[model samples]
Target: MVRTPLTPEERRRGERLGALLREARGGRSMIEIAASAGISAETLRKIETGRAPTPAFFTVAALAGALGLSMDEILTRCAPEPDAVPLAG
Candidate 1:
């Protein structure tokens, strides 16, 4: 199946998600966190570095669970500002 390309805004949001995850990780080792999340360290690294932005939903759920982040928090932290104008169709 073909995948749609991410928009600039989506890319920015992904970067923000990466940053948030990194900050939440604190001093924990990547391997430890990755294991707890049931994912490989390389996959976590890719997400943290924004190299694999838009990971699968379950992967994100696992990461969020391991990191003690709520879905609401993720949405609040990663979403664009409320006042930002929407892109023209």
Candidate 2:
């Protein structure tokens, strides 16, 4: 099956995630963070620069873990709306 490209919103999400990681990684070198995240320095650089927007889920998860960012925080930060009502239970 053919694969569709990521939407603009998804790309923005990736950029937001990258910014968060950079903030969390303050005072740390890219190599150190990449090593801790189990990814190559170039991969981390791409992600951090939004060059690899919409990176694989596993990659995001690993980076989040290494950067010490909680899922809730990432979601809240990357989400477009902060006050959108949730669906009724």
Candidate 3:
């Protein structure tokens, strides 16, 4: 089945994820990171610039692992909120 095009919110979240990764990857070479993330340098470059909004799961998993970001943190950060809710005890 064909996947629907990403909604505006999804696109924005992807942009957010890209931004976070870019900031966390400061001083690191794109080629190195992308290879470690099991993706192409071009793919990583596009994602970093928000040109590639929707990347594959495994690709994200690799990058997230390398970046020390949990999936929950990525999702929470990518989404906009008036105030962030701290995890409950």
Candidate 4:
């Protein structure tokens, strides 16, 4: 199936998610975190680097569990700024 291209906002949101994950992963090795999350280090690295921004739901859940982050917090943190106006398509 062909995937639709991501909008710039989506890219920025992904970057924000990556940053949050990296911050939550402090003091832990990527291998350790990945193993705990039941994912490969490379996959974790990709997510953390925004190379694989749009990860699957389960993958995100696992990562959140591993990092002790709540989905609600993730949603809140990754949301676009309240004052930022959306561009007309």
Candidate 5:
């Protein structure tokens, strides 16, 4: 089945996710992390660069496990806060 294109908001969320992953990675090599996650370095690279915005669920789970991050923590960090209010000009 053909996948639908990602909306702008999804792209933005993906960018946020990528940033969080990068921060969590710290000084670790990408290859090492990818291997530990049971994924190819290229796949990890794409996700980290936001080239692969919507990764498979299992892939994300594996990455989270390898990085010592909880899915809840990842979601909390990547998702926008519902209580955030826009500043009035």
Candidate 6:
């Protein structure tokens, strides 16, 4: 199946999510965190680097649980910038 290209906004949101996860990781090793989240180190690395911008919901939940982050926090932090104008169709 073909995948749709991510929009600029989606890219930005992914970057934000990546940064947030990276920060939350603190000094923890990527491998350690990935294991705790029941994912591969490479998968965590991709998400952290914004290479895998849109991960599966379960993957995100697992990561959040491992990082002690609430989904609400993620949603809030990843929200569009206040100054960003809505995209017109």
Best candidate, lDDT-wise?
6
Provide TM-scores for the models: 0.86, 0.78, 0.77, 0.89, 0.86, 0.90
Pitting candidate 5 against candidate 6, the one with the higher lDDT is 6
lDDT preference between candidates 3 and 5, better one = 5
User: What is the lDDT ranking, best to worst?
Assistant: 6, 4, 1, 5, 2, 3
lDDT tens per residue, model 2, 3-79: 68888787888798789888989999999999998999999999889888777878877888888988788778877
lDDT of 3 by residue, 1-89 (tens): 99798877778878998999898788888888887887889999888888888888878889998777898877778866455678999
TM-score leaderboard ranking: 6, 4, 5, 1, 2, 3
lDDT of 4 by residue, 1-89 (tens): 99999988788888999999999999999999999999999999998899988888899899999999999999999987577688999
| Pairs with backbone N, CA or C atoms under 3 Å apart (clashes), candidate 1 | none
Q: Which 10 consecutive positions of candidate 5 have the poorest summed lDDT?
A: 76-85
Assess candidate 3 and give its TM-score to the true structure: 0.77
Clashing pairs in 6: none
- Model 1, 1-89: lDDT tens per residue? 99899987778788988999999999999999999999999999999998888888899889999999998898899997566687999
Clashes of 3: 0
Cα lDDT listed for each candidate: 0.90, 0.84, 0.83, 0.92, 0.89, 0.94
Off by over 4 Å in 1: 83-89
For candidate 5, the per-residue lDDT at 39 reads 99
**lDDT tens string, model 6, 1-89?**
99999998888888999999999999999999999999999999999899998889899999999999999999999888788688999
Total colliding residue pairs, candidate 1: 0
- How far residue 25's Cα lies from its native spot in candidate 2, in Å, is 0.7
